[model samples]
Target: MGALAGLAPIFGAIGTGISVLGTIQAGREAKAQADYQAKVQEMQADEAQAASQRDAAATYRQGRLIASQQRAAVAGAGGDLTDPSVIDIMADTDFETDLAARTDIYRGEQQARGLNDAAVNSRISGKNAQKAAFISAAGNLFSGVSNMYSRFGAQAKTTATASGSTRPLYG
Candidate 1:
């Protein structure tokens, strides 16, 4: 029993160390998960920008094709390409096509901006997780020390009382 009692502190210390390590490991995993999420968000942002560019290019191509077809149609119908009304129609088509393409680009940019914000948020979350883990580990260490003192301190008090000693057994 005395031998076991002497080993109690060693066992407690080992337990405390394991607990602190586990807490720190959990925190690291959380940070890692957040980092992975941030990476995914960054990739998504890149894809959003690329998709926007592709959409804008397609819009421009379609607009050019429509304009060309309209011009061909006018020529086939014996219409004068230099007439004021014909020129106005072509201009309107060009304007509308440009507006639509620009709108697509704007929409895409907004989406990419949102995704980038999410990525930043994820990275912040990761940092917070890491900080929290360190705090938890410190708390575990303190708790373990307190537990050890309480257990040993109580035993000292008990022994002092049994011996009818007026002096406190421990400071």
Candidate 2:
């Protein structure tokens, strides 16, 4: 019983150390997970941007083909292909096509930005988790040390009383 009592503080310290290590491990895992998620987000954003640019190019090509066909039709019908009305119509068609393509690209860019923001937020959260883990570990260690000292002090008082001493034996 005396031996066990004497060893109690050592055991408590060991237990506290293990708990702190586990906390630190958990923090590291969270940070790794966040980094992976951030990488995935960046990859997805790149893919989306590429797809948007490709679609925009295709839309511009289609618009050009359609405008050419309209001009050819006007020329065949004996209408003045250089007439202001015809020119305006062709220009409007081109503008509309360009607008649609640009809109698609813009939407994709916005989505990519959102994903990037989320990734950043995740990273920040992971860092916060690590900080919390460290704080908790410190608290646990302090509590464990306090308890160990209290127990030792109580044991010393008991021994001193039994020995009929006016002061603690070790002191």
lDDT leader? 1
All candidates' lDDT scores? 0.90, 0.86
lDDT of 1 at 156: 64
For 1-171, candidate 1 gives per-residue lDDT tens digits of: 999999998899999999999999998999899999989988998888888888888998999999999999999999999999989999999998899888888888899899889989998998898899999999999999999988776766676655456887795
Q: RMSD of candidate 1 to the true fold? A: 5.1
lDDT score of residue 78 within candidate 1: 98
Q: How accurate is candidate 2 locally (lDDT)?
A: 0.86
Candidate 2: lDDT of 99? Answer: 98
lDDT per residue for candidate 2 within 41-139, as digits (tens), equals: 888888888888888888899999999999999999999977999999999999999998998799789888988888888888888888888888888
Instruction: Give every collision pair in model 2.
Output: none
Best by TM-score: 1
